[model samples]
Target: MRVLAGLIVASLLAAAPAQAQTVFAPDDPGSSGQPGGWVNDQWNFLPGTGVDAPRAWGNLIAKGRPGGIGVRVAVLDTGLAYADRGRFRRSPDISRFRLARGRDFCPHAGPGEDPCDGEDAYPDDPNGHGTHVASTIGEATANAIGVTGLAYGATLLPIKVLDRDGYGDQQSITAGIRYAVAHGAQIINLSFEFGTLVSSARQIPLVLSAVKHARRRGVLVVAAAGNAAQARVAYPAALPGVVSVGAVTEDGCLADYSDSGPGLDIVAPGGGDDALRPGEPQCRPGVALRPIVQMTYAGSKHRFGLPRDYVGTSMAAPHVSAAAALVIASGILGPKPTPQALEQRLKATARDAGPPGPDQAYGAGILDAGAATAP
Candidate 1:
């Protein structure tokens, strides 16, 4: 019995991946990809970089037709610019996929009323949050333009649920989900979350019902757990059936600001404020990795100009959403995978991180797109 047990342990040890491998930026993202962007950074790839989902998963993406094409992902946040300002825009460059017409549900008639005042005829992200999240989801990757996105083949629908102040009520979010579900969005990326923990009860039926509606329609909802720096996850993420995500640094650990607990499903490279690991600098280049990179709006005088950076589970959630889009587009899971099926694939294929099995910190594990999309 001792000899048998020893053999089993040895086999297990041999199969395990190197836990503390060194991480470094790739010499180049590609001939088309430029440096200084988060997705182009080394953390998005290589075994030991942060969440451990390498961009090598992209090799499969190149061998086949672009997978995310025809898959529509709704960015239920601020919005995206219809016109080109700086290097970001919703058309021409990002025109590979068809962008669905979006709407605004900002309430002028109070928290949950129908007499809401919609902003523009088209979606526009003034606060820069929605634009950043949308770009991370799909930003015309490898087009010899700007930074790359994980699923550049996916179409983005800019549903403006949050206002210029980056604040939105329950009704707006509820309305946004319903709109996306009704309009045929395969995935809904909800990077915004309530600041505090809120119960999903009858009083909050609109938002809860909307999430339920999306699930029923087979639309995947990916959300940020929150930035509370504690164990409690906030609402939307706290609700049932949502894909809750937490943030991690580029060194394969949870960020100091990411929220965790019952709701978190997985983690992604959201970067850190002052990340610490063996043989790494205290801060990334110019507040870079501290806040994950994406093409966004900066009012004036900012890095990346139209393409800047931000730190939070907000950044992390979209990376997961992008991975989901990649999986759906890859056709590896089948032609039309139900939301539940896709979610299961993600959980099953995720690289195990933190304590073995599922834990709040890393959930099933950091998302492994390559394995998830593998034949």
Candidate 2:
């Protein structure tokens, strides 16, 4: 099986609180009832500890685009629970957002053999990872149900490169990248990376070429730095022009499992145990922090729940992707801003973390969606 850069530990079922303070209420009522409850569970969107999504939401609301409207973000990973067909069911919270008819690049022989059979027209997520990542980028805001996506107004293109087992080869991933660019995806979120063992970009020439192709086409590619806790970042993300994102915990410290090194661009909330950093009060080693929560399949594709084990740089990349979409919609960099401009804005507006300047661990620092899209 091909190795995925992200780590998926065992999960526990958790429910959202029924009541919480409302931050920014969208005009549209969500499919579910409790719009305010998202504030209770989503600490990753809070002011200091998280990305500060409310500020971004308010900015977008003033601009008339509530959640990065018109931006198309392509999620390249295991399929998403986007559509309901056969045994699959879309996550209740994610159902409200607009989705493109995404393609499945990884095709297998029989349905019984692989969950992601090539027969389907839509990229339905058999593994919950892609769905979780997509939801983080554009799940649906103020929709009462589970949680709020940073760019809920943006269109999501679910490109299934990995199989149900969360394993994918270079060919499928390469195809997925090219497909997203050709399909007008403004931002591509790559939440999975090659193993740390596959260190050199020379090893994955096709994937690297595809990423460069996307960059040339002005598509912003955001990727996970990897979760190996290694000094060097993993491939694809480490590639030039791609926004390499690392993971930070609830305490705003680097996640214990997040890989760090040169080429790392930014950091976001991935949620889990904090790394041991002397003098940093937030870095409480050994304490189990709350994981990034999103509505995903409980165990089977038929059931949907909030699983609290989704932690890694894989989880961190989508936050940047969503922020990129918001920046695109905000008109801060004009209507058609280049990927480089978007990256620079996100890094420049990011809240500084770790050391004094941009370090290897925290990159440009934790993502601040509110400030990045501020008018």
lDDT of 1: 0.66
Model 2: colliding residue pairs? 34-144, 79-125, 80-125
Clashing pairs in 1: 67-329, 272-290
Top candidate on lDDT is 2
**Candidate 1 Cα deviation (angstroms), residue 27:** 12
Off by over 4 Å in 2: 1-5, 10-35, 109-116
Error of 2 at 39 (Å): 1.4
State residue 332's C-alpha deviation in candidate 2, in Å.
0.1
For candidate 1, give the lDDT of residue 359: 88
Each prediction's TM-score versus the true structure: 0.79, 0.92
What root-mean-square deviation over C-alphas does model 2 reach? 4.9
Write candidate 1's Cα lDDT for 209-257 as tens digits. 8899899888999888877776877667777889988877765567777
Model 2, total clashes: 3
**What Cα-based lDDT does every candidate model obtain?**
0.66, 0.84
What lDDT score goes with residue 143 in model 1?
53
